[model samples]
Target: EITGLDDKDTVFRTVPSDDYQGRALARTLKEKGYDKVAVAYINNDYGTGLANAFKAEFEAQGGEIAGFAAHEDGKASYRSNLAELSSGGADTLVIFDYGDGTGLTILRQALENGFFEKFVGGDGMKSDAPINELGAENLATFVASSPVGEKSDSLDIFNDAYKAAGGDPDAIFVTTSYDAAFLLALAVEKAGGDKAGVSAALREISNGEGEAILPGEWEKAKKLIAAGTAIDYKGAAGDHNFDAAGDVPGTYALFEVGADGFEVMVEMK
Candidate 1:
């Protein structure tokens, strides 16, 4: 979505692209009855790509984009930027930047300057930094869109294992990260340790047509691979049914700041 790296044959992602996330964010805002909003994005591939996608979809769905602009990271002040964004009479501001970096700066300035009454963010803004830095009470109207793995036995198995290892299964990107590593191992096994064959093997192992292999089923997967039987991986995140581009469609949810941290507010379509 951002870098277009999925076009490369050697590249395979266990995670979904920002294209899906952008659309999901737009749908979330619209469903929540926000008819007008402003968008602020970082001046990079990730931010620009998601911002544009959201703008296109939101406008197509009869929503109004009051303002849109990109900003450089590491700026000490974003007050002017926030003012410009809020000038179009939009009470909601959507941000496409990382919460731990320039996004935090922008958000802080926005709040102090009273630029917008409500706030929204993409996955990048779904971080603990904001709640810790700004306080959850001050962010009651803040929400973010993030990918959520589909509920399944595969997810349950992975969650249990992750917990037993003293890790937080709910951590962001943990499921996808684990799935990527496991899939790579499976690809290596299916390719008989040939690096050059790993890409092709990756496609064959999870193309949605084969024996279903769940999390923690390494022995079963290895046996199937050695026996020349195709095995499709049901990953902890989701069934990684890779498309022609080796990309997986994603499911998303809207989350809001809570007393403990972020809590799911609703599932996004």
Candidate 2:
């Protein structure tokens, strides 16, 4: 979504692109009745991509972008930036930066100076650092959006098996990473260990058709591959049905800082 990398057949992401995430955030804010907002993003690829995507979607949805600007990372001060953003009289601020770095600093300054009445962030701001450092009480009106794995029997099985293997299923992106590796292995098997055939074989396995293969069903997948039977992998993350460009549509959820940590408030459409 950022660099048009989807055009490369050999390149694919187990994670969804920022395009999906940005649209999700925009739609979520609109659903929550925030018709006007400000945006502050770090001056980098990830930040710029999300910020631009969100701006486009928000404006198209009849929402107003009152303020928009980019700031350098690791800055000692973002007050100027905040002042500019708040100049538009937007009560809500949408941040697209890492919560552990510049995002935390910006949030601190914003809160200290009362730059905005509410705060929202992208997946990068979903880190625990903000809530831990700033205190959950101070963030009652704060929320963040992040990609979430769809719940299914495949996910349940992965959770159970991962627990048995002493792994944390809830760790960020764990399911997606697992699915990446598992899918690669299946592709290799289906391709008869031929590297040149792996890419094509990948799509053949998970194109949203054929017999379903759940997590930890490696043996079954191997047997089916050996017998030339088509198998569709139902990953812990999602079905991972790759489109022509090798990109998969993703799911997202809105989260708020809770006493225990970030808690899901709603699934974003």
Candidate 3:
């Protein structure tokens, strides 16, 4: 929703934008080198946007989409649509949906019915439902494209504090929430304490302006701001440098289920 708000002072993101996510999916599809693909998307804006983006990129990369279908969300079953999607002789199927509950059921049902063995998906499939339902061995053929951060020393400090504060370090968006909250607070302080001043302050402190501020150094950060120091606040998730469009670029990776659990197959560049 916050995309293309470069003219305004709005900056909103805990996760990646949809366009990058589609590119991530396309990247994973190319990595697996599937010549023919089929798509099963949730009949919604999110799914449609991803479907179009993935279709364009995948085809541009010399891949063929043999079939495409959209299934309603929250349905008990999608066997009919799954069968149709897989009937085009495509070796790989890409399902685009919020997969925790609705899409997981469909994927498992498709697998149970022997619809297809290989799949390429997005961050929506980052949940445990797929593995829990299909088992890791069965899900080994599935590959996921999603955001994953590079290893950072700051994450250790934040994770330590997170555990102490009764927060689950393994939880989704834990790092993002922490980073955003602290960055907003720091920006507010630097902006002289008001929503009116926060927009510019956020950019001032985040985009490599002055001295680098690491995690757990908020007190020092405040002092530096008080001293008229334009300090850059690098959180546990690394830099929060919002660009001209108030969007921060993030990394992508391919995730696949292994014997134990999800493992990073490759960090996409």
Candidate 4:
């Protein structure tokens, strides 16, 4: 009946959860010994939630939030907000926004003002498009964290599967969406293709009812499932098993923007 798939049993994750990312970022900045930081975010769920999370975590870590700025959607200019962040006495600036165009606009303004020495971004800015839009020279001091990439050994499997399926394995969304599809398919198959059965199967899978399937082991998982073996799918994004909060413990990598592309700086635990 698809009843169990409601907000309760069903998982709702944005690759890297804003809360986790925020905390991790705070920890990273603290490790780097930053005292004051400014936050600039989009006026949306993605941005606001992440900014709040970062602020809470940073404060808990004995860091101060120097300033906070939110930009409306469709707003092309971020000069005013950047000005505020610049004058906020922050050494580091955190950005929580999506889209290369907006990110470039904000970064350009921030750089022009000479407000921050380091710029950090959430998963929303973990794309090549930003560097492409702003030019690498302008993004030299920018960094980001995201749930995708080859941070884990398990990603090898997902990469092979994606290529076999004629897809680009490096595309963040592609691997995540593929893993979701595989999990759904496995559940359905275990439930004997019955929707009700699938719902029941999800609980079993979530509760450690089988061997964990790491990325690239989907074919092995399919065979095991066919052989009446239970399986737990550790996805390319991270472990697909959702906790009580309906959130999965995902992996994220800190990336530095370079002239050619982005390089992985650190993988968060």
Point to the candidate with the largest lDDT: 2
Q: What are the runs in model 2 whose C-alpha is more than 4 Å off?
A: 1-3, 6-8, 163-168
Flag regions of model 4 displaced more than 4 Å.
1-8, 12-16, 149-153, 160-174, 211-223
Candidate of highest TM-score: 1
lDDT of model 2 at position 177: 92
lDDT of 1 by residue, 109-150 (tens): 888988999999999999989998999999999999887778
RMSD after Cα superposition, model 3: 2.2
Native RMSD of candidate 4 (Å): 3.6
Clashes of each: 0, 0, 0, 2
lDDT of 1: 0.89
Q: What is the lDDT of residue 213 in candidate 4?
A: 78
lDDT of 2 by residue, 1-269 (tens): 53366455887667888888898889889988999999999999999999999999999999999999999998799999999999999999999999999999999999999999999999899887998899999999999988778999999999999899997676567788999999999999998899899999999999888899999999999998889889999999898988767788878889998887888999998
Give the Å shift of residue 67 in candidate 4: 0.7
Pull out the clashing pairs in model 4: 157-216, 158-216
lDDT by residue for model 4 (195-259), tens: 76765676565456688877656578778878987787766766666655555666676888765
Query: Model 1, stretches more than 4 Å misplaced?
Result: 1-8
Give the per-residue lDDT digits (tens) of candidate 3, residues 104-151. Answer: 987888788888878877777777778877788788788877665546
TM-scores of all predicted structures: 0.96, 0.94, 0.90, 0.85
Question: Per-model C-alpha lDDT, please?
Answer: 0.89, 0.90, 0.78, 0.73
- Total clashing pairs in model 2: 0
